[model samples]
Target chain A: MKTTNKIITNINQVSVDQVGIGDRVSRITARSVKNEAKIQGLKMALNMIDLTTLEGADTVNKVKQLCYKGMHLHDAYPDLPTVAAICVYPNFVGLAKEQLKGSGINVASVATAFPSGNSSLEVKITDTKMALDAGADEVDMVISRGKFHQGEYNYVFDEIAKIKETCGKNVRLKTILETGELGSLDNVRKASDIAMYAGSDFIKTSTGKISPAATLPVTLVMLEAIKDYYYETGIQIGMKPAGGISNSKLALHYLMLVKETLGDKWLTNQWFRFGASSLANDILMQLEKQRTGNYQSKDYFSKD
Target chain B: MYIGGKFPRTESGRYFTLKNAKGEEIANMCKGSRKDFRNAVVEARKAFEPWSNKTAYNRSQILYRIAEMLEGRKAQFIDELMQMGSTKKQADEEVFTSIDRLIYYAGWADKYQQISSSVNPVSGAFFNFTVLEPTGVVTAIAPEENGLIGLVSVIAPIIVSGNSCIVLASESKALCSVSFAEVINSSDVPGGVINILTGNAEELIPHFSTHMDVNSMLYCGDDKKSIQLIKENSAINLKRIVIKKDIDWMKDEAESPYFITKFTEVKTTWHPIEKIGASGSGY
Candidate 1:
């Protein structure tokens, strides 16, 4: 979709009802999913994960291990689905790409000065180019929070548009708003609108480096933006709530929110993704517990 | 009731009639299910770190506070015991003994490590010492006969060493268990440190044994089938199993530092020693 002057002008008028969103989220969380439906939700949440290892201490061995874990979540449990992607820093994109080959799992690499978009446009472009050249299937770029906070909405829009241009049509580009740094639900909605209009295939919640990475209310605001965007344009943008969602029950709650907000079309991994690392094992543990009539320990699952 | 520091009904919403020895209904107790046991284990695991990291002196203070709270509510416990068909003298003795047992374990809380841990001599130039650490979450079945005393006897020793526990109260004699839980709640004891559940041992034993998050299993009865089931399921995670079969809770032998040692693990650390001189004068 084209970024028109009309869209930029409409961004300011988009305000969120904080109390209403909170009430809606509470109602959604109160709905329980049990038994067979719970198992199915657990599996769906597992498949939606982008098993991530984005750390300064991350190494080739760690990335490779994470990729392996993404493919084979738990071998003992039959018919377990693999994770959708393996997320890592730009440097390990090629290694993750190689490790995930033929397994049908995508390799997602964080780019554009990820976690903190403090770099220049030239450096951000190089960062995206580096991951793309390494054959990263998806590029997760961070929005310039400094510029956005300064009310430079045009700069943020132009930056995402430029990165989307660099990615072209084949490669999907996910825009990380780093919602923790965005300050409020209003800013989150504004940023979500900017990213979608500027050609972000998916709008993500956080970089996972911030304290309050992904919260229910912030995600709900972003989902409402996605819904509004889908209505405006025929195109559909994915929603990804990354970081701090480490348990199966919370993950299931996220799935419930997504379903209630955006409907069934966005339930698949193609449209929804969890930018998390430890969340995979928790979901695996829940699945194993269901398979065997016993609660599982973290010792049994692989730590990636 | 009293799972995770708060009094909550069983998630299963099922209750069983508690009858007196004369076959008269006394109360309807929660028939705690596996899911309740699971939730209690989750709470116990959450409480383990903070509870175990508390100073030994603080743990002792908490245990002593529990004893004090029980002493304050002694008449209520005696009344519950009588309602459960105990003689007035027997009820009095049981409540007093339960209070005393808590005090006994309270005194041993900070001192057990001194008697149990040791510095060992090794061939290598290393200072090797073995210290006792509280095993994580423990699941215990309180003895069936002495409701208050058995519950106190099993819980005091296990928790004195900083371990958190989820205890299934005696099925037939459970009224005192709930009353004791009220005393514990009023005590300075942290929630989840001692979660008491009223349920059948036969129904909850398998879950108590199989829960992987539980570090140890303590059984207070002599049922061969239940003991064998605990033994077999404990192998799944190699959880430490302590079976107190054929033991009389009223005897002094029931309250021992050795009981505290059963729920603790020995962690030996080897620190390299630097030789001072050829004669190793620093040693």
Candidate 2:
């Protein structure tokens, strides 16, 4: 039998060495990918994106444009792959789903008092239910940082479990720790373990609303937790480093870190995803640069 | 040696030997590749907004500060000019001229926009006028002759208009360019406002012209083949290409408000006005 209960109980025992992580991340990022491999990495990163727009000002047209962008990406490059999914707020999930119909791009929605998990259990349950009812293939829920900081690990665990239960077996749950507020790398690792054992299908770094979002060092810590979880229960969990990863070169570095830490099995869209909006255009620009042998201008790319 | 706000070696790690008039090796200059040019353009683009948003008087003061720093290091520039085959008197003259050229451009910084802008009379109920704006980032190939004065002349005019620039220093006479970078660093001029690279103009000119992020290009040489290449590549982004051929930098005619206008774009605006009475609008 798997030792899920024991792992959850021992979450506090997981300590992250700040020095070791810093050195390893530097080494991983220093390994440059170039030429044909660079092109390949850029394409793979383009495919693994969860193009998100979760602003309070988001509208029907903006969500439609984002969904269209997810499918078309860049029509000039006929060989380009569409993004993995379209991420939006719950209200736009229905429209995004309608726009992305039959395009094979899943619709992900942020729910459960997203970016700030300050609501009650009933409110959180209703939030998840609203997203699922609107045809969200994935739900990105923020954990209760207030609870986690208060040493109420059980409350945090129960909240994620309740939302995962609402997700059923169909919808994947991406628990955003908002690592910028998590205080330390040790808390990040503990929070990763809690989300995984509480049945989160993906452990995301941030909600894109916080500073210090999804840094390479924090992503490494989460990946290590996922690796340990997989070794313990043989259940592989996905990783998504959302926010602030805008350029192609930095995206490649993240991919390198993933491959090195979690192995090749976690390299697909099903296992690894980037929750970013601007990252798509940048990757497309790099692909175009590789195709045309000239640096690209932002004027040519779409703003959405 | 200067990119972004720091002095860093070329990322390509390639170097070429610089020789004195006697053909003896003096120093190894960074053989900046297309990637270095690309990196500098990235920094220049990032630095454009803040640098351009600065008040004209502030930019004027910074340019004057560069002249002051250059004056303090006049002996070093004179020494480098002599190493590139100038006599003691010629070196002294070139250094003094370069410093004076910087001060000239500094004085022009806040005044050029006034002379360049114009009010136009339209045939409708509107006020039409035009004002000059910095043309984003510019890439230039410094003149091959008069090492220090030519570099100073090309750079001061372009940046005096609030445009950031990436300049390839004179290949044969590259020493003063590196020392000039030191002066720019110590001066109040912001980093990336002026990035100087030492490399072969022939190798870098194609990239300098074709870069989509660069808004304009300045070529100070008369090589027909290179000029043809620049004209062709600059078409990719429709970048404004200014070709200065056979210009003596030491002359008073070389430094003009027209030089600053070359790197500026005219933005014309029209504001609607209600007619007061049947007569034409009141002044």
Candidate 3:
């Protein structure tokens, strides 16, 4: 109830218990309008990416080439590289499901108190079930970093347990620690332990909301945690360092980190994933050079 | 001016160094002078036909797309501003304002002809009409205080109405201005419609303001001696001079007159609409 005023007035933190002046309302109005355009652009951009092939062309001609090449690859490589699943909010689980049918790729949707994970158990569990029922094969859920910081380790562990229980057979659970806010390598390691011990199929690095998500050091710490957990429990947890990675060199660096840290089992698309807006093209750019034996212009593949 | 994706820089690659706010050399900008300005004017003079002949709505669409591109690269602009030593808040505001300026010009491109009075009453049977037209190529000295926004404010208005400009970059900060030129070049803004330069205003502006071929001179310099030189130089060609103190484009829509006054070439076509009565009556 207090937040309505702050959201309406936009005076710093909405959660604060202070009365904001009318002057602040303009700031709020301006911010909301600004956010509207950005949100629309992001939604449209995401919808246009054909994630099944991860073959994006910057121009119309590139699109044609990609189309022909995709078909040829489909026919020839019959067992070609599988793209990571399409990620979306719970509402779009069905949409991802519909678009990716008979395509052998998985559909991943964030559920169970995503980003913040600041909600009741009933709500989180219900959200995960809905995503799975709507045909999400991989459900990425965020852990409550706030609770974890507040020494509510058991509470965080219980939430992941409920999600893992709900995931059942065909579905997998990715418990996100949001390491950016979680603070240090030690915090990341502990959070990784909690998620794996409670039976997460994978441990994710962020909600893509925080500033410091998915750094190599943070990810490296997480991989070490995953390896240690595997040595003790024999249950291998997957890793997805999603957010802000814009190219292939960074992805390759992350790949190198994973292979060195966890060894061969983590190399497959089943275990390793990079979440980003520009990472696909960077990967494809590398693939192009490898396939064609020449380096292309930085703008050769559209950065769009 | 070639009207394509590529705009030829002035024939002279001659340029001057631009400093950041900290007085460090950032870039050597393409320093165009009054001579280069005259050349750009000549190019724009040649280009005025096909560009102005196009429908207003089409011009407006092109301007709007320029705004979109600016919006997409707002972060990049801010980063450049930071490189040129502006704070984050100031950089962000300048970038956003630059984009808004494009939107402002976009709204005016089609409707600029309608916003003023054109009716004239004559005592005789002869009819007279007054419509705004481009004066010719504009010779502008862009403001130095607000880096990118001020630069766009001065340049966009002049070009939106089909006039072209020879804009001197800011004395210290020129990265954003040159970056803007790159954006305009990519946006298909007809070459010579905007020619950017970075150099000593005193050395370059004399030739620019005094050039007989240039139709006008826009001064951002408020100092008395500089103003005198600009005014004195204009005496040679009678260039329409818009002084700094006179224009406060920050508060209002400022693109219309800046352009209409510089680019429009007025020429009336006359034909006899009357026919001799009962002559050639085939009925």
Candidate 4:
């Protein structure tokens, strides 16, 4: 039976006077703490994308399997595990789109120059169009690192805006502000503002191409930008810290910054997502460890 | 949730663009302000009379209703939390803590008086006694972190004591706080018993602290400026100020007892036991 006030009265009668106030406090604290600990196990979930670091045709099947793995495992764990989206080049968008058909998880394609933003605007737009036409729900577009570094921020902004305008509300635009190239927190903040002003749907930390692309500070800066912008405009932008988010504890910390910085309204797939090749299984392993207090199968995860 | 008949969060969510780890757009949060905070206080003050005057048994039921709403919407709370960028685990904790705070407070409405006070020995002949009472309108500046629980911890304590509070909530985490207010509405807190403001605290604190009519102010924030403002505004009318130190709120401390001390007043009435009879018997 659900406990009633009568039950509470009975509970109150339980020789609490014999229990020191400290002990009662500790006892109550433990229950909440245990709940909090269990919650930790569930929250650090990630969408793992094992970038084979491959090119073109070789990427399709691997992408398909990763999507399949995500879908199937998600069927088991439901909300427990995030099906890391299929991260791939523009050409394989069709394959991933077809293979992962009907799977609610994202088919995120790398566009706007992919790993490098060295391409012409025409080529970048075409790549993004192809990916969108291929059923990519999210477009992870790399911003022009050279142009941004050279401080041609407006150009980068225009390009991202064009991409966003082209994606036209159907596809979410994740503008990658390669932090390795952005140089500092201020730049990260500036780039984040530019991307939002330019109409980018989400501001991602890296294209996972550059070294030191996704650091805690960079992500923190980006999240702060999203938060500040939303506070200013009544619009909430998503935050994704791709690459190097390999540890569950780190992921949890990221969640902390996001939670505390943004508030609970932004805590969802729509507001928060992580992009990494290795974070999912690690988080899964940790969650399993938390559940049973023993290590479980890491092999179950599709090698990210 | 509901404040002054309308649901509101503490922050005036000015910043838009909810980004994901990959940087995506999520949803919109309000840009709350100090005016809103003060307005909430106004509502709480208005709501205080009937609510405070309600028998303790009724207050307990209303608080219990809040606990029920919190429990019922737990999942939505979790989902909203995720979008706010909390991991599933962290989201779960936020939800659990929120619900627990309500349930914890619900238990205190009827029992706090039993905990913090005892009969005072009187030198006079009449029945002299003391009891705690509500401090009317109050203002609270919640902590920057632990969005849901922290907000709950402040608002619940203030209202449980029958004082309505205008609170400034964590701006970033206003979603749950917003939604939690709906829970309060459903739970039966009279309109204005708790009002929340969400935005730059600097902008909002001065108004609430210095408001001439405010009866008390709670300083729950870490910034020194908030303290200075609390001091400055409180001086205008000498509002009873409570500067809550940052302690491990994770532990219960059974602090319901403290609320009794905060809101109650001692009453002593004197009556002589010996004299009258003998005067008539002087014959």
In model 4 chain B, where is the ten-residue run with the lowest total lDDT?
B274-283
Candidate rank order under TM-score: 2, 1, 4, 3
Candidate 1, residue A77: lDDT: 90
Model 4, residue B245: displacement in angstroms? 59
Query: Model 3, stretches more than 4 Å misplaced?
Result: A1-82, A289-304, B1-283
Reference-based TM-score of each model: 0.91, 0.96, 0.43, 0.44
At residue A99, candidate 2 shows an lDDT of: 97
- How many residue-pair clashes does candidate 2 contain? 0
Backbone clashes in model 3: 7
Question: What TM-score would you give candidate 3 relative to the actual structure?
Answer: 0.43
Cα lDDT tens digits, model 4, A1-304, are 1322332233223231223433433443333223456455345345333222235445555767766666665343446654656667777778877876776666778887778889999988998889888877788888887887776766777788789988988788888888888666667777777788778888888877679967766676677678777887888798888888887666666666677678777666677777776676666655654554332334345564
Relative to the real complex, the DockQ score for model 2 comes to 0.73
DockQ values, each candidate: 0.71, 0.73, 0.03, 0.01
A1-304: candidate 1 lDDT, tens digit per residue: 3455777788788889999999999998888888899999999999999999988999888888888888889898998999999999999999998998999999998999887899999999999999999999899999999999998888999999999999999899999999999888999999999999999999999999998999999999999999988998979999999999999899999999999899999999999999898898888888888889799887788787
After aligning candidate 2 to the native by TM-score, how far in Å is the CA of B27 from where it should be? 2.2
Best candidate, TM-score? 2
For model 3 chain B, where is the 10-residue window of minimal lDDT?
B1-10
- How much is the lDDT of residue A200 in candidate 4? 84
Output DockQ, candidate 4. Answer: 0.01
Predicted complex 4: CAPRI docking category: incorrect
